[model samples]
Target: MLLMHSQVKAKTPPTGLMSNTEQDQQFQVLVEQHKGILYKVAKTYCQDESERQDLIQEIMIQLWQAFPRYNPQYKISTWVYRIAINVAISFFRKYQRRKSSVDLSDPPMYITEPENVEKEAQLQLLEQFIHELRDIDKALMLLYLEDRSQAEIAEILGLSLSNVSTKVGRIKEQLKRRFSNHKI
Candidate 1:
């Protein structure tokens, strides 16, 4: 159970406006409602447990900063996804530059093995296949697997609808080939 850091608590608006408790409450609710977005993004981009926690904190801080300026017309989930994905990409890139060693043996912390051994192996393979994708494609696939609409994915990724569709089809084919090649 992650709590908001004190540093990210509601701050006075820049225009000499006092902080509104009501607005703060609203922001808190927004975060509570979409908290999974933070975790999923963090897990996808970070392999280390501590790094994932740091990434989630970073995402929360950014979300707090941007909350006041958030527009109401757009879907909240879409807004949250956009911010989380962008932060994860930047964080991953920074960590990659500083990383000294690669650890491929550890499974993602978010994955829980199913009862069936074959199913668990396939799930692990799928996760590996997803992690191999380019950053943008990885974001796209995450959103897609979450069952977001193509229109929503396009909006989140700032790609054209056709482009989103084309890339998704290609990624699916690539994953299929990987699985096929793994078979004896």
Candidate 2:
């Protein structure tokens, strides 16, 4: 089980006025607590390693900017997912526009091979299928795959609960067909 980093202590700033150091410490703690979500979002949206890293950095920056306004009423994971997914979608859109003219025929090679080749192959195929999905569907599938509750997924994605349920069913059927058709 992954554990969040211990919170760092900083001198309390005046009410409604966080010192830079205090703000940094607070942001660091939040990021440490939610970094896996950020990475998963980045990876789902970006196929290229460099682009994935860029997306992660961009998400962190956006999260930091939005941290001060975060409402404690909502779960932190919900807020993080909302921001991370938005940033990822934006990043992907910009990246697609920029790369429209570039040749993407040559795929980047992975340096380290997984010890379990069969499991890695299956994961790769799943990722490929996920990348082929529409943006909203991709986000839905990511949250679903994480075993999040339908209500939580709906809240994070700003969809009605019924809509989330319907979309999840459709997405699962789509994945099932893809997996059945492809011998991965």
TM-score of every model versus the real structure: 0.76, 0.78
Name the runs in model 1 displaced over 4 angstroms.
1-19, 91-115
- Assess candidate 2 and give its lDDT: 0.76
Worst 10 residues of 2 by lDDT: 6-15
State the lDDT at 81 in candidate 1. Answer: 93
Candidate 2 lDDT by residue in tens digits, 71-100: 666777888899999998874444453322
Q: Please give the distance, in angstroms, between residue 59's alpha carbon in candidate 2 and its true position after superposition.
A: 0.7
Question: What residue runs in model 2 are displaced by over 4 Å at the alpha carbon?
Answer: 1-17, 91-115
The numbered model that scores best in TM-score is: 2
lDDT scores in order = 0.73, 0.76
- Deviation (Å) of 42 in candidate 2: 0.2
Q: lDDT per residue, candidate 1, 1-184, as tens digits?
A: 1122332432233112435665566667667767777777777777666667667777777787887776545667887898898888884444544332322233445545456667878877888888888999999989988999999999999999999999999999998999999985
Checking candidate 1 for backbone clashes, the offending pairs are none
